[model samples]
Target chain A: MKKLINYTPSTATRLFLGLLPFALLLLVYMGASEARLAENPNDRLLPSLTQMGDAIERLAMEPSKRTGELTFWQDTQSSLIRLLSGVAIAALFGLVLGLLTGALPVLNAWLAPLLTVISLIPPLAVLPILFIAIGLGEASKITLITIGIAPFIARDIQRSTQQIPTEQLVKAQTLGASTLQILMRVLLPQIMPRLIDAVRLSLGAGWLFLIAAEAISSTDGLGYRIFLVRRYMSMDIILPYVMWITLLAFLFDYLLGLLNRRLHPWSEGTNA
Target chain B: MSEPLIQATNVGKTYGQDVILERVNVDVHEGEFITLVGASGCGKSTFLKMILGTEQSSTGSLLLNGKPMPNEPGPDRGIVFQQYSVFPHMTVLDNVVAARGFQKASLTGLLFGRQKRQARDDAAAILEQVGLGHALKRYPHELSGGMKQRLAIAQAVICKPKILLLDEPFGALDPGIRADMHALILDLWKTHKLTIFMVTHDLKEGFYLGTRLWVFDKLRHDPQAPNAYGASITYDLPVSQEGRDTLDEITRQLGASRPTIPYKETA
Candidate 1:
């Protein structure tokens, strides 16, 4: 046998190894669920796979008792609307602010300290203030998500903007570019791919803030559904909802990665 | 004599207490290739930056055609650094085309439709002349050091600046590639009648490429405060005809300094 360090896995073996842990987790959950149910048929801690499937069908296919709407799709839609709106606004404002502060020394000096202080403040602590100021409607939740991630994105963009080579800027100026031209032409395009990457990194935090706000106060959302069902210990519904959320987050991440690679081929290929 | 295109009087620069260059005065006429040589940290690059207008001389004045050099970098002055001077996001063709667009257009830094097609044709012709026609679609990262420098040269010259500044443009290339670059630069300089200022670590390169050569070194040295005195143009030799003795003197002086030796003494 080859030494472990020297041995490299083939493509097929690598795929199998990647899937092993996930399969093991599934088996463990199924076995524990069976044992619990065999001991007490009424145990709600671990729902059998079939029970979770049934809960998913009911939530996905049937109308809710009170609202007459499919709770599953409704919750997903509401949560997605909030998440997208907040992230979109953050991206727009972040790009503008980051571009200005990074390219202009005066703006950088004035705003860098302020941005640093704002990023340092825990966004969740400000959630209560946001609810009081903006109210506990869709606006408050969206603002929470926006406030939670915009600074991070802006700060990231500022750094990437600053990181653009001085040579490139000088070259542009020598070509007779105005200050605004250099910003839009030389600096802006270079940092754009980086901005997409920064947004990708901040998505996880965005999801967290979204769920926190929804769980605290919301009539409809993925987090609201999960928290509402928890009163009856319906692990069947909660587990499937959790699985759904994970799938959505995974899909989002995959799509963003694809967009980055597609739109910014140079950034992905090699260092400049 | 006709007026010199560029004139300097008592040019000096300092950052805080660190004096980098001082009391530098020279006159460069049109179409003269002036190469600068100095030890590392001797402010050769600093002097080039001053000429490029990215940096200003702190103490003295520099003139172009009997007027002050523009405070902001403009189309009259084009420059190429050793590396990282090309736009990686753009393909070779776009890099050259963008230079023109940046100078002409007010926003988006782009030309569209008929103007865009015209720009592309002009860029293509220049790239072809630089032997980069085949790689017009390639990004900067995809090209080798030599090719990137070619692209840089193409970009610098596309705007037809009155002066071209190269700061060790070929320093990172291998010898075989450097020779090709030297030929290309000379050809371009002759064809375009460009007034060029280049800084090189290699003394032989300065001698071979430039009509006139300059050496930057400090006359005084203080042990405790190394930067108390700034470097000045120690030797201004016309390398086209009488540089042998000046080369020997430079090599001997560089040998004695024991550090920052940019050239070797030849027996």
Candidate 2:
């Protein structure tokens, strides 16, 4: 059970401060738009706005119409597949690199320069080169996202693993635990909170990279729809699409936050 | 002759240029309760580490039951550190069962099976011994300081180690809790016949619990940088056979300055 918060405004405060300014702004914008519509009665902007409004209305009327109802399901499906594959590959590589660098100072020193150079190469900068190598396909996009996010994950996990308490390790050793047992039981459990945090953070990074990847080269998908609207200067369509994407991003963040809270209850008391 | 359970001969340690201990000899008789009393930096904790095989001795050798000490720690010796070293993520039951996993009592000796009933039973019995049976399901964070120390003790002794090394085990508790802990430990020692080696700054505690007291006085060697030269045994009193007699002698020694006589009979 959670505590409730009171946010009601006093009657005097509400009467003095609320509603008037926002009401006025809406009216002014509608009046200006009406005046513009009178001059250009058959403008394409009006039709596009109507189309976007119609889409929203249809979505509200029948939510299932927006569910699994994209013409580019194949492309979306393939993109999803590539994204999951890339995550798996990147996670494996990142874990290996993290373990090597974390356990051995010499390995860390050797990889430091390389990792720095790799991190500095922004995702956008490499899209063009990746297009040349893999030709504007799933490979190029997935590779770009993987390379962009893996370093962040690797660095986070490495630090988490290294921060395991020395006393705990000594205690485990004195308990007759073998190296494998110590790693599996002591080291892994201690690092789990940080590892889960890193994974959630990386998921956000993955979503950002997904949008950027789609915008760069794709005939369909959410990012392609936004890019298509941008070319025609259809601000109305663009705004609604941006709102939809923001809602999706918000949902992802919320779900991940709920999971983090459930898994690490100790963190919530301090953080809240 | 009954063999010494723990024989540390000429045990010494050094941290770079500074020597913490040198030529320190200790023989822990089987089932004998001993306390090593010293000031800070007397290397008492370091000596315990050496016995536990967590830290290497610079010189000399330590043997357990006439067997050469292994390169790594084993279940033959259990240790309770001054700091509550129990695993915070695990329940009290899990922490105790962790060390017991390698023992023969494991289910078909398989690594992962339903929790071994016998091990749980054993852990429960030991927890009962430590008066922490009701805390079986509680995490380390849920326990108080004294309870945490008791859990640590339970965890260390669950495996039935031949020798139990405690380094200031109750030093962190409050006065009331500390006294309670002292009595609890003494009771456990008597019932289990555990060869206990404890390090403490509390002279009264050392006198109350230890069968024999080994005092490390720093002021005896160098008054200015007293801790530089490793601590020497300033007073070695036997308290096992003569508990009251020993207490009176200690009181007399405390009152008298440089008393020549070793033992004084109580009227």
Candidate 3:
């Protein structure tokens, strides 16, 4: 095998690069806030480092008061459950629809217009109708995510399935492989790299939609906590929660990126 | 004598308004190495396709082992294409073992590990035969052009088909590698006694490896027309035994003052 040049950054290097900016910003903010607090201890806009540390301790100690504490953890858990289940359901639907549309031209033509129309309507626009039909509860949020994500996944899978070379299919047929056999042995293996890429894209989109969904209507969630803190102009509490959310998102994204790299080593050079 | 392994009677093919081949007749005997030499667009590949059952002959019949060919590809005939046709994602072993997926190898036999041992053994043996024993775990992208061609040949022959069809298998290789592959093919043929039908445009290759050479002369009739007929026959020269002697005599005559007769036809 030919030796490939190693120019791409390793995972540890990427993580360090991603976190450096936030660390620097936090240090500058800490120094500036300390000076402001020392000048005017009673200023509503400024909070001392000790006061911010006290707020963190208080939020951790009293889980009942300060809607931020209860709402953040509750929303985080609910959003995760809905995202997981919604992804499962959407993948099931996408796999079937993608397979059928890829195998039959007539079905693809018939479903093209309907899928386009459905995909065109923004999930936010359909939120009210979803709320009216299913009430303002977990169902609404889960359904919103499912509708938002299924089309993109289906489209990605269908295009990937279609892009497999005809020569490979012909070779499989010459080997006496049946339709199912060909799909399982030849088509699936060839399209797996593309499918994993699509799934990673969908995961990012799913998180974005979850935040938007939680921000719209919810008694609890990380988004709701951030919004509630903003109303009182409490940057101390809001900044920490924002830090937590950013850290979580980064963790998920980094983990998925690692999985993608591990599964497809050939894709590393193209992933910049 | 028994019947030829493959017989084509008035086999014809037409694509819409264009006639590719018409009334083509050929009989391939067992263990006979035949080379079909033709210029491009002479329908040599189409004829091979008809034999492989990948394309339908619009007019007549084709028989393999004195039996009618089905509408799809079968294991009775194995084909090696000119381009790299191995599966890119599969290892060399998987690519070779895939040909047996439809035969006695059952789904349960494959899943429960009954066929794995046999497949590995067979793949190793065939890879050794084709000088690719060390490349069993390598993918297609890791192989060179010559190695890829050798892998294709090994994959085709691993199925043990009755007739092996090669469509310009060596046209893409360099001259040195092509010569080496030709010698390897001849050695394998001597041991396996396979009925080989190859399509090549190289005249020297045809003279070296073909038991019977078919020359497709396009300039026979109308020189201006693109479509022309051709002829072929078994080379029945006594030079098969005394080819070196004949070359020496020709050199001696050329060196002499007297010009030798160049028009004498020998058989």
Q: Which candidate number maximizes TM-score?
A: 1
- Local error of candidate 1 at B185, Å? 0.6
CAPRI-wise, candidate 3 is: incorrect
For residues B1-267, could you state the per-residue lDDT of candidate 3 as single tens digits? 778887888777777755566666777789888777554555677777777777888887888877887776766677777764676767778787775554543431132276767877887888888889998888777778788888888877777777788888888788888878998899877887888878876655655786765543222334454344332221222223435554444334323412333212211
Candidate 3 runs further than 4 Å off: A1-62, A66-71, A103-124, A133-135, A227-230, A233-246, A264-272, B9-14, B17-19, B36-42, B59-68, B102-111, B200-203, B213-267
Error of 3 at B259 (Å): 35
For A1-272, candidate 2 gives per-residue lDDT tens digits of 43446666689889767887878866776676667777886554433446567755543444344455443343346556655666666766776676556655688899956876776778778778889988987788788778878887778777766765555656655566666676566655555566556666777677677778888787655666667767977656565666666665567568767876677554432200
lDDT of 1 at B176: 85
DockQ of 3: 0.21
Per-residue lDDT for B36-151 in model 1, tens only?
99888889999888888878889989999999887767788889889888988999999999998987758767888998999999999999999999999988888999999999
- Return the clash pairs for model 1, or none: none
- Supply every candidate's count of residue pairs whose N, Cα or C atoms clash at under 3 angstroms: 0, 0, 1
- Give the per-residue Cα lDDT of candidate 1 at B211: 95
Q: Classify candidate 2 by CAPRI docking class.
A: incorrect
Give the worst 10-residue stretch by lDDT in candidate 1 chain B.
Answer: B258-267
- TM-score, chain B, each candidate: 0.95, 0.81, 0.79
* TM-score of candidate 2 on Cα atoms, chains taken together: 0.76
After superposition, candidate 2 runs with Cα above 4 Å error: A1-135, A263-272, B66-68, B104-115, B217-228, B232-234, B241-267
